[model samples]
Target: MSEMLEVKEQETLSETVPVFGYELIREVLLPDILGEETPKILYWAGKNLARKYPLKSASEIITFFKQAGWGDLRVVKESKNEQILELSSEMIVNRMKTNGKTTFQLEAGFLAQQYEGQKQVITEAFEHPKKRSAKVQFTIKWDMKDFA
Candidate 1:
């Protein structure tokens, strides 16, 4: 009975396997393959993802980011034409701490595309990475005249 219980427990534990070596693909391999266009490609891919998800509100967007393992997304500020968001995560910190000049254009572009779809406008996003703080701030802006 004791051996059977141990086997069951081990099986349960083994069901929850953790993924490893993602950084090698995301940080190194993709960049090496994409080179100068890595940022652009990532940004567009993020936008494409947003289009598929099509969230309704800012809170939903934040939740999506968390669920997608992107990071903690918070609203720093909001205005008639712009919204500022701060993103931070373990991966983000590790990248910033080790790789001085890394970019999170994917997150920025995702926000931009989500906002654009929601507001029915042409939106653009810019990323500002703070290495010391190990966070990325995204500023998403839209023009009222450019309707989608």
Candidate 2:
């Protein structure tokens, strides 16, 4: 009975939301305002977070993205039963600059850097470090068509 209580406690703790900020930055706020570079870092962060939580399929990942308010998840090119998912967020163009050299920047340099600092499980840079503004691309490949 005590073991059950302990498990319950852990579950409760994990579901608790903080009053400070979100663990995963939403997809909508990444691209335009954050710059072209943010999509990759956000995508990587989303992937890592999904793995940590371990969703059964890509659709589940989409749902997770939606629930997080990242943005509208869309399948751009679907071949056979597999498709590529593209996530985008609205960006405030004027807010894209940072004062630091490389590390101070977010989205491309800053976003990737911060996501890297999380030590979650992401290590891939979506774009070249020097160029923080680029296309936002994330590919989701799977065979489950009706997955949610």
Candidate 3:
């Protein structure tokens, strides 16, 4: 199982897919089907995905984001109970330009779940999309006294 997971992660690292298909589903089809609840549903879906593909550390989470074509993620700041991460990519820029209502809730939820798994604490994440900068900032926070 571990080997298969490793292979799956590595396989997509260098693979490329046409963005049109991805956009067609994510931007068009999903919104059409999910309607106003799309962001909320996608956020929960991301958390479920994290559960299925748990990573042991922050580095692994970063790699997973890249492999999954989310973006280039970097830790901007870290403190005792919170961490700030920034995500950017050409795809992100394009999405922001094309869709004014773009949301990064999915990535935010993924980060929240990943950190919860790693820290064994109750964690939550908030997404701040900077349309002007074409980047998304994720603020992941955990209650030190709360355990998962």
Candidate 4:
């Protein structure tokens, strides 16, 4: 809803998300634009999301949901400290995966389908009765353990 894009990454938690003017566009936004092929698109979206926000820890990513108007994002798995994000939205899920059909619908739908099996999809959504948005729930997982 806002034109100004405020993006930053934090290994350590920093920057608080403001309420309103934010929409859950990750899952819905990426897929429609890049269809048939989902890997490249998902990768870019994940990287971009990681870069845009200072999601240092798994919990922080969850908190981003409430701030971004998305649902309750959570982490259900941990591979030696590496957490995975699961995003879902009933409203957005039922929508088509075609590009440019509807900005929010397309974006939310794309994000949901693209991350399926490829990574941990942690996000959910609810159709706004009056507003032109939905509540998406998802988690963002990162590789915390590195091998040498």
Candidate 5:
């Protein structure tokens, strides 16, 4: 008489999973592939992504960033045609501590494109990395006359 071995079924569960080592893609591979044009390319790519995921309001946009692992996005100041935003996170702080020259061009471009669509005007964004504060700032500006 031969004994048969019983097989166990694998567990199948659904849950939200966090992505790890995204910096390797953002900080290393992308720059290596794009070379000198990394910043510009990433900026345009971010704008393209913003078009795909059009958020209705600034709060929604901020929520999107948090859900997408971008960080905490907050409007520090807003004027007639200009908006200043700050982004901070544990990842950002760690990156700043380890790397002195981190760029946030992708975030800048995303903000620029989103603002342009929301205001129906041509918009531009500049990124300022605060190494000391371990944060990144974005300044989005638009001209009143130029309609998008």
Candidate 6:
């Protein structure tokens, strides 16, 4: 009985929302409500969300991105003060094809805050969407001199 319950819990945790529903809210409704400021607002919103769901390691952040249906996140490069992460998915490809101006500011901000929490330093992230490649690259940089 306990084994079955555990399986059920795992299944529930892994359940995902349909892509159409997600796109409707994220692309349509949000833009309609927030207008030109949508991208900026989403970036800050992602930071707040990171604060609410803090994770200890890069692996945990990667897992969280998958669980949240954002995309498959992987570290492309890492240095002392900077890290490059790439996110790719079929959904991301679709979004890029459908909307040329699609922004990944939310994901960028999430990464920035997560790294800030991990390194205890002030961090910022920039999103570069590769429309041709159908991927988004995030460059996260931390100021070692500025402690958070």
Predicted model with the maximum TM-score: 3
User: Model 3 compared with the native: what TM-score?
Assistant: 0.94
Q: What is the lDDT of every predicted structure here?
A: 0.82, 0.38, 0.90, 0.38, 0.80, 0.88
What tens-digit string does per-residue lDDT give for candidate 4 at 1-148?
1112223223214655432112234434444566745545444455455444433344554555544434545554546423344444543343323222433332333333333323444432211221233333333233323211
Give RMSD (Å) of candidate 4 vs. truth.
10.5
Q: Which stretches of candidate 4 lie over 4 Å from their true place?
A: 1-35, 81-85, 96-148
Which candidate, 1 or 3, has the higher TM-score?
3
CA RMSD, predictions in order: 8.6, 11.6, 1.7, 10.5, 11.2, 4.3
Minimal lDDT window, size 10, model 4: 123-132
**Distance from true location, Cα of 47 in model 6, Å:** 0.3
TM-scores of all predicted structures: 0.85, 0.35, 0.94, 0.38, 0.86, 0.91
lDDT of each residue in 113-133, candidate 6, tens digit only = 999999999999999998889
- Candidates arranged by TM-score, highest first: 3, 6, 5, 1, 4, 2
Badly placed stretches (over 4 Å) of model 6 are 1-11
Identify the superior model by TM-score, candidate 4 or candidate 6: 6
Model 3 segments beyond 4 Å from truth? 1-4, 13-15
Model 1 scores a TM of 0.85
- Model 2 residue pairs with clashes: 27-70, 28-70, 28-89, 32-91, 33-91, 33-92, 105-110, 106-110, 106-111, 107-111
In the range 17-88, model 2's lDDT, one tens digit per residue, is: 542233223324344466766645555555454344444444644554444444444555656433344545
Candidate that scores best on lDDT: 3
Query: 58-77, model 5: which lDDT tens digit per residue?
Result: 88778767766779999999
* Tens digits of per-residue lDDT for model 1, 11-61: 666454232365677788889999989999999988997887777888888
* Best-to-worst ranking by lDDT: 3, 6, 1, 5, 4, 2
Error of 3 at 31 (Å): 0.8
